[model samples]
Structures are given as structure tokens and as C-alpha cells.
Target: MARYNSWQNRSLIRAAEALTDAARWQDRGAFFGSIAATLNHLYWADALILARLMGNERPQDTITHSLTNPADWQDYRLLRRRRDRQIERWAADLKDAELSGTVVWYQAGGATRVTTSRALCAVQLFNHQTHHRGQVHAMLTAAGAKPDVTDLTSLG
Candidate 1:
């Protein structure tokens, strides 16, 4: 799933790169309002969720503020690519015993601490990426950018 996440992100980001800055950031009336914003949201969520899974410090940015930074397409792309590699490395190192272990972290505002199985947290990270990436795929297609196939089987 980490590989798939990275693969699809590469495709989507590459396709998004074909568009003008104005086009990529243009409001298309989607949930996040534009491809750029939606991708930013995904990057934010992935960073936070992956941090949780890896037992790292939770990001200081709240969900409401997730879309505020890395506004430049190049910066967002670089950070996202680096994040994908980090997630892949973490996934590769995970042992079967760790799957049953629990990860504890604070929710968005640090108000409540929640504990969950490492397995479920992993799924949440990947699933959340796919969900929002779909939104980006739709917006990209609407803007006439052709991302490569999203099929997991298509990953080489």
C-alpha cells in the first residue's frame, strides 16, 4: 500500500505539473476547492498520520491549518516525495509483531489521546491518501491532465 501510495502520487503530481500554476491552483469547486489545495491537504494528513504510526511527535499544524503551507507546487512536491520515501522505509521495517502493537497519539488539537492498533493506523494512513487522491484525480482530469493509471496492479 505504501508503494501504491507513492506510485499514484508520482502519477498525479506529474500530471499536475503539466498544468499552469494558475490552472493547478484554480478553484474547481471541489472539497478543497482546487487540485493544489486538495494535494496539500493530503500531504498534511499523511505527515500527521505517518508520524502517529511511527511514534513521532504529532505535527503542530491543526487540520484547519493543514492547507496553509508549502503552497508552492515545487515545495509541496519535494516534501511529498520525501514523505513517501519515509513512509515506505517505515513500512518496510515494520515487523509482524508490531502489527498487533498499539500507537497512542493526540487528536488534532491535542485535547484527547487515542490508542489504536498499529495495523489499523497503517490502513488509515493509506486509505486516507487514496480517498483524497481520488479527489485530485478527478480535478486533474476535469482540468484535462492525464495521470497514469491508478490501478494497484499497474505499479511496477
Candidate 2:
């Protein structure tokens, strides 16, 4: 799943590179507003969720502001690419016992939230990325950028 997540992300980012700054930043009426914003949201979610998976502290407030303008796109792309590698390594090292363990995270209001299964938490991370990446794919295609095929069967 991590492999797929990383592949899809790379594909989307590569396609987004084909777009001009204006097109990348244009509002598409999606939840995150634009392709860049959607990608930033995915990166933000991944960072927070992976930190929880590794029993680490949350990331800083860089993403607490606007998602589209979270950071320079090129810089964020590099960071996200590195993060994807980390997630892949983590997934490869994951054990069955850890999958059944519980994970806890905090919400925006300092509310405590618990996930009964760590595996479910991992699943949710990929699911979250897929959901938003689908939006990005649609938006990219609408703007005539060619994102790679999302089918897992042929991806390998």
C-alpha cells in the first residue's frame, strides 16, 4: 500500500509539473481548492499519520495555514518524496503484532482520539491519499496534463 501511495504521488507530482503555476494554483472547487493544495493536504496528512505510526511527535504548524501555499512547490515535492521513501521503509519493516496494536492521536482541539488497530491507521493514510489524489487526477486531466495510470494491476 505504501508503495502504491508513493507511486501515485510521484505520478501526480510529475503531471503537476507539466502545469503552469497559474493552472496548478487554480481553484477546482475541490475540498483543498487546487491540485497543489490537494497534494499539500496529502503530504500534511501523511506526515501527521506517519509520526503517530512511529510513536513520534506531530509535525510543526507549517501546514496549519493554507495548503496550496504550504511551502514552495519544489521544496514540498522533495520533502514529500523523501517522506514517501520513509513510509515505504516503515511499511516494509512493519510486523503483524504491531498491526494489531492501538494508536492514539490528538485532534485540533486537543481532543484525544484512538484507533483500535494500527493497521487500520495505516490503511486510512493510504485511503486518504487515494481520495485526494483522485481529485487531483481529475483536475489534472481536465487541464490536459497526463497523469500516469492509477491501475495497480499494471503498475508493477
Candidate 3:
């Protein structure tokens, strides 16, 4: 799944390269409002979830900042690449015992604490990526940028 995440991200970034920055940032009325915003949200969410799974401090930026922190598209791409590598390394080091454990985290924007299966957290990470990427995929296609095949079987 980590490899798939990285591969799909690379494919999307490459496809997005054909568009000008203005086009990528232009509002298309998706959940995050634009391709750039959606990608930013995905990156922020992934980083936070991974931090929770690894018992690290959450990033300082709030959800609102996700759209503008790495303001430049090029910077976003570079950070996303680094994040993908971190995820891959985490997956490689994971042990069976780790998945059986639980992960506890505070609800976003609240003091309430939540606990869930570590494995489920991992599932959310990949699932969230796929969900937003699908949005980006549609937006990209509508904008005339052809993303590569998304099949997991194509990972090879």
C-alpha cells in the first residue's frame, strides 16, 4: 500500500506538471476547492496520521493551513515525495505485534481522546490518500492532464 501510494503520487505529480501553477490552483469546486488544495490536505493528513502511528508530535499547522503551508507547488511536490519515503520506511519496519496494538489520539479541534486499532489507522492513511487522489484524478482529467494507470497490479 505504501508503494502504491508513492507510485500513484508520482504519477499524479508528473501529470500535473503540464499545467501552469494558476491552472493547478484554480478552483474547480471539489471538496478542497482545487487540485492544489486537495493535495495539500492529503499531505497534511498523512503526515499527522503517520506521526500518531509512530508516537511522534503532531505537526504544528492546523487543518486550515494545509492549503497554504507549502505554498509553492514545487515545494509541495518535494515535501510529498519526502513524506512518501517516510511512509515506505515505516511500512518496511512494521512488525505484526505493532498492528495488534492500539493508537490513541485527540480528535481534531477537540480535547476528546480517541483510541483505535493500529491496523485501522494504517488503513485510514492509505484510504484517505486514495479518496483525495481520486478527486485529483477527476480534476486532472477534466483539465486535460492524463494521469497514469492506478491499478495496484501496475505497481510492478
lDDT of all predictions, in order shown? 0.85, 0.82, 0.88
As a TM-score, model 1 comes out at 0.91
Q: Please identify model 2 stretches exceeding 4 Å from their true place.
A: 57-66
Model 3, 48-97: lDDT tens digits are 89988986533333433468667798899999999999999999999989
**Residue range with the least summed lDDT across 10 consecutive positions in model 2:** 57-66
CA shift at 102, candidate 3, in angstroms? 0.9
**lDDT per residue (tens digit) for residues 21-42 in model 1:** 9998899999989899899888
CA lDDT of 125 in candidate 2?
81
lDDT of 2 by residue, 1-156 (tens): 889988998899899899888788899999888888888888878887888777753333333534854557788788888989999999999888888878776665455555547888888888888899999999999999999999998678
CA-only RMSD, every prediction: 2.0, 2.1, 1.9
Better model by lDDT, 2 or 3? 3
For candidate 2, the lDDT comes to 0.82
Question: Model 1 off-target regions past 4 Å?
Answer: 61-65
TM-score of each: 0.91, 0.90, 0.93
- Give the RMSD in angstroms, all C-alphas superposed, for model 3: 1.9
Model 1 backbone overlap count? 0
